[model samples]
Target chain A: MNWLTWRQHRAQFLFGAATLAVITLFLVPSGLGIWHTFRSTGLAGCLAVTGRDCGDLASTFSDRYTGLQFTIPLFMILPALLGVFWGAPLVAREIEQGTHRLAWTQGLTRLRWMSTKVVTLVLATLAGAAVFAFLLSWWSRPFVAASDNRFSFGVFDLRGIVPVAYALFALAAGVAAGALIRRTVAAMGATLGAYVAVRTGIELWARPHYEAARTISYSFFGSGPHPGSGDWVLSTRTVDRAGHLLGNGQSLDFNVLHARCPDLPGPSSGFVSKAPIQACIQRLGIHLQATYQPGNRYWLFQGIESAIFVGLALGLLAFAVWWVRRKVA
Target chain B: MTTPAALTATALGKRYRGHWGLRDCSLEIPAGRISALVGPNGAGKTTLLHLATGLLAPTAGTIETLGRTPGEDPDLLPRIGFMAQDVPLYRSFRVREMLEFGRRTNPGRWDAELAQGRMDRASIDLDQRAGTLSGGQRAQVALALALAKRPELLLLDEPLAALDPLARREFLKALMEGAVDGEVTVVLSSHLLTDLERVCDHLVVLSGGRTQVAGDIEGLLEAHRVLTGPRRDVDRIEGVAAVVQQATTDRQSTLLVRTDGPIIDPAWSVHRVDLEELVLGYLGQPNATALPAPRLARTGAEVSR
Candidate 1:
């Protein structure tokens, strides 16, 4: 049964392997060059000096890797491709062509036939995803080390163990859709729509609530450092000393203030610098209250997100098994 | 020791949605003989064949083939060979690969020598893909695959329906040779009764999702007679068990009937019924209630033989 499944799906498996190989070939040499440049520029040593200053060195490194960083979003499409091409046609083509009758009546039972095909293909998908995640994460190590901001949506999903989970979820969704729909092209379409919907929903609504965000209040300064660059700021608003929420009435109150203090910059000024606004807000006893998720929680959030996707994948696979065994003709 | 019948059904039926494709069909096909199942379109012939082959499960009662229930039992698969309607095969596979597929799927039950001999004799080039073969050649390849399983009972559903006359003859010839040499019981379904007259010794007639006639061919033919006489009411004729058909004219009447004893009406002429006439008489009347219920019953002589 294993041998038969491999023979039937050999074309799809080869295509996936070839795509992974091409990606590796493109990333390996360029990744080595980036690492060499980072070492030669003493950027690592400067970044290690923590409290001193390495902003200039970090900016140079960011400028050099800007082109390669743009391709990070392309890695997200790999799971959708696996879903549409490898998983949708797995059973849909069998039924659409009436070859399922031929396959079901053989010596093996229907459950065994379904399990053999699904399990083998899932393992193949996992292997391909593992290779991809390793290559991309290794290539992005220097950038992550210098900048230390891996919590962004695209970078987070494209780098860690989460891509494997995403790939598995996509495969399971495609299989479930194929089993229910019983048509290859329509199942592929359903898979694409469902994958996009779930990913977007999680990224927007479900992810932030995984752990409660913390709030902090700080005095306003003209050109002083506020929050760290890695902190994902949810929202920032001005509040009184008692921590009561204050609405943005700067336009009306500041207008009154401008009438009272004729020395302040007028509306006709080409540019009103931040110094006056800061002095005015400080005198009014207003402070900046900001909510954010700190960067130290990156891996914890990744683990939680991966668990959510894995749970969905397993649920979809169970539905697919039942649908194949009971509902399919 | 006496062997069980090749197939036995007690009130077997299959329903699609709310409508019954086969209803209250009880039949027995005897072992080691070629039986012909004759029916018009939508008369439940294919339904019965599929049920027996385990391609479908019955909704009502029981059906046992070779003394075991059909479907999902690995032991039963080795004993039954079924070539479904239109002979579906993997078109992408070469003929040799298709044969290999059968061997691999059936594992311990395949006969390689028999399949190779049949393929060679039929002049089927195994190197050619199945999609490239003509309809007749495809049927031949399908038949060879079924026969290679060495099944005890083989059920073929309309294998000859799409063939030309020459191709039909060749296919039937191969079937007969396989049946005689391998001693396998076979049930073939078709609407053309005359074509089955020469090869089939056992017969079953079905119409309107019901069995109209079933028995040994010679016995069924012998039990019926066509009597032509002057115009007279059929009830007046003595020893007429049941009138299957009646044709009246201004001067004379022709009656087809089943009789238990000799017809004592000296004014009438009695003629023997052939396979075609007997099958046609039942098929012409979709409603079997018009005929006597007792006489419509089948003796199933082959099962008891």
Candidate 2:
């Protein structure tokens, strides 16, 4: 079985390795350029700041990280494409081409034949994912550490162990889809669709729960007293769980709001002071802050999620095996 | 007699939904016999081979290869080599790589020299990818893979359907040579009757998913006859037992008859039916019944008139 699988998929393994090497070679230089741009600019210091001002600087830093971080999404998508077209086709092509009948009639059982292919291709997918994860993580560490933006969470979350999970799930999904569909084009489309759905579902809805929760204040009002004499303070603000404002966890200062709203009457000019805006200020407490701090417990959360996907993958794989075993051409 | 039969199928039946692929098709092949499975398109020849080789499960029957049920016995798989009608070969694999894979996966001992010899005889290019090969070459490569395994029972579906006359002759010759000295039982399905007549001792003709006629080649030929004469003289014929096939016009009638004695009547002329004519008669008429054995000339000659 080992020898059969090795012979069957050696070409795919070589092609995958070559593709990974070429991508790394092409992207590493560009990645270094982004890193150099960060080191030369003073924006790196903004990452160390602990206030709303730092959040503003972090947005700027995110733009710098985008150059290198862009590869993370590409890595996530390209491997799945390859798995669908290349890995999925492994068995389908044999069956489509009529080679499976020849192999099945030989001494090897259908179960053993399919098992060899899945195991070999799975190992290859893991190796490719590992290399991609290592390179992407190593390159994007500086920028990811600086940004601290929630948007950057998608990028950082995908680069390291997350991509491995995605690739494994995609490979299994591709193989299962191919076995079920039995057509290359349909299998490829089904695999890509499933991959996108799983990635989107996990990133948008599931992974956030693994991190510290945070809430954003969507109200278009500033956190301060409204001065009388036709003065109204309007500002958009967001905050987190610690009663800290959105950009960074800092208490809102009404003195600054009053200064910005110069229309406020002199200190005693029939101004309501803090009374008029107190109701609006209390509404700020209604906003919930659940910040995702995945780094603190990366392994624990990753293990749980990986287990779930792995189980799904294995279950799908078993179904594919059974289908192939019982299938009649 | 002590040795086990190479292949056996008992009450073997296969049904897809309501359509019958094969039904009540039972056959037994003794050791070292080249059996030919002959049928027209969609006669379930390939389905029967698939069932016997364990590529497909029989819906309500048992198939035993080398004394073990094919589906339940894993060890029997390695001993039986099957080449489906749609010769399945990996497009990416070169001829050499395909043979290597066969030798590695097959439980039988690898015969590298034999494989190379067969490839050389077939004139197959070792470096060419299987997908790039021509149809005849693909068939040859498929045959080579099956032959390389040195299986106990070789079940080939339409192995010679795609080959040209020259390649077909060469492949059959190589196959016969391989089976000559071993206990190998070759059950090959082919539409080409000439090849079957040349190499096969046992012949089975399937029509409409059932075995219409199956027996030794000489026995089948001896039992059937083609009787042709004027249409008006048909009733004048005596000792006419059963008609396998009949074509009549205004003046002439050609009837394929099965009988055991001579047609002594002067009005009708008798001719011995060859394997081709017998098979054609059975295929031409679906409702043919058993006919009496034809009579042989008293001279004890091989050919009878």
Candidate 3:
């Protein structure tokens, strides 16, 4: 069974190797170039320096490599690509070609055939995703140094063990969809769609809420919440002396400002100016506050997200085995 | 102890989404005999073969091949070889790889010598991809895979469909050579009666999702005869056990009847029926029963008829 799986999937392995080589050709130069610029511009030292804010210098250096941001996000599609190309066709191709009859009747059980192919492909997917994440993490190091933020959407998933978990989920989803649908092209499409949906759905609805966001407050008119710099600020709001809620961007109206600080200013075009509002807030002892997931929790969040994806992957694979064994031909 | 049948099914039935593909089918093909499974389209012939392979499970009753239920026991698979009608092979694999696949998959039972001989006899190119091969080559490769497993019972569905007349003759000749001297029991299902008659010793006829007639060919042939006489009621004929087919002109009535004894009526002439005529006679009238044999594959040729 193992021999058959390898013989059948050798073409896919070769394609994967060639694809990795092409990606390496592109990653090596950009990574080195970014590293060189960071050193030359003195921002590399600031990555380790803790005394002062490096935001200005970091932004200037990072802006020079704007092309890096665009290209790196493209790697995010690798998981879905694995699902479509590797997972969807694994079993679908066999049934579609009517070779399941040949494979199942050759003294080996169907369960063995399914498990062998799935296990072999899964090991390969994990190894490939791990290697990819390593290169991506290495290449994006200067970006991390410049931004001091690892939780950025496109950037975060690219640099951690979560990508490996996502790869597993994608591959399993593909295989399960293939087993259920029994059509290679349709299963491939479903795998791609499901991978993207689950990934973005988790990022948008599940990740931030893994733990409650911590709150930090600052005096009005002062440099506000520099302590929340590396964290993901879900929202920033103003609170009064008594801790009454204030507008967040548009949470409060100009009428409320007029009612509280009547002598400050009148509404212009249904909006109050920020200068007077800042003065009124200072006069009232209102505070600016940020709700965020702390940057120090990066690895913890990575662990948690990886657990969710890997759990989902295992579930999908289990469902696939059950479907193949019980429901399918 | 009596030897167990190579393949047997009791009240075997399969139902698809909205209709039954096979129903109330019970048959036992004896060991060491080549059997022909004959049926019209939608007659459950392929369904019976699929049930034997355990590819499609029986919905109603049990089907046992080589004395074990397929799909329930993994060990039974290697013991029963099956050639599906379409001759589905791995299109991407080279002929060499397919043989390797058979060898690797069937581990202990695989006969590498027999496989190589089949390849050589067919003059198959080892380097060529199966997808690129001609239809004849594909069928040969399929057969080679099934045969090289050295199964005790081989179920072949439409195995000779893709071959030419000469190839068909050679194929039947090969099957005759295999089953006559070897331990393998082959059940070949095809519409070509001539080809089947050349190789098969036992017979099974399926129609309307049921077994119409099943017995040894020679015995079935012997028990049935065509009687030409004056047009009269068949029920009045004392020697005839059952009427399989009836045709009449203005003054003459010809009846094909299954008899337990010789037709001795002076008014009628009895002619021994051929294999094709016997099968067609049974098939022409779906309701005809050839007087159920003692066994599914029983040869009652020693009887008076």
Task: Tell me candidate 1's interface RMSD.
Answer: 2.2
Candidate 3 lDDT by residue in tens digits, A1-329: 88888899999988987888888888898778878888988888876767667778888987788866667557989888889999999889888988877787778887888888889999999998998888889888788867767898888899878889999999999999999999999999999899989999999999989898888887766664344346777777877887778765325566777779987666664655678887887777877777888888889999999999999999999999878866676
Summarize candidate 1's per-residue lDDT along B1-305 as a digit string, tens digits. Answer: 13458998888888998899999887778898789988998999888987886767888998998888876465776688777777778788889988887787777888888888888878999999988988888888888778888889988888888888888888888888777777799999998877788889888887777777777777677778999999976665687666777789999998777776789889899999888877777677555322223434543211110
Instruction: Between candidates 1 and 3, name the one with more favorable TM-score.
Output: 3
Q: What's the distance in Å from true for residue B186, model 2?
A: 1.3
In the order shown, the candidates' DockQ scores are 0.39, 0.60, 0.72
Q: Report the C-alpha lDDT of model 3 over B173-292, residue by residue, as the tens digit.
A: 656655555688989998778888977888999988888888888888988899998987656566776677889998999988887787788889999999998888878988765435
Clash pairs of candidate 3?
A: none
For model 3 chain B, give the 10-residue run with minimal summed lDDT.
B296-305
Q: What docking grade does candidate 2 earn?
A: medium
TM-score on alpha carbons, each prediction:
0.86, 0.80, 0.93
Tens digits of per-residue lDDT, candidate 2, A190-294, equal 889988888678766775565444333433343332111111112234453355554333445555334434554444565556643454344444232333343
Q: Score candidate 3 by lDDT.
A: 0.83
The number of the candidate with the highest DockQ is 3
Model 1 CAPRI rating? acceptable
Please state the error at residue A186 of candidate 2 in Å: 1.9
Best model per lDDT: 3
- The whole-model lDDT of each prediction reads 0.79, 0.70, 0.83
- The alpha-carbon lDDT assigned to residue B30 of candidate 1 equals 84
Candidate 2 residue spans exceeding 4 A from truth: A1-4, A26-60, A66-69, A149-153, A208-299, B1-5, B123-125, B131-137, B228-241, B251-253, B260-268, B289-305
In model 1, where do residues sit more than 4 Å from their true spots?
A36-45, A48-73, A143-147, A219-232, A235-275, B1-3, B248-252, B289-305
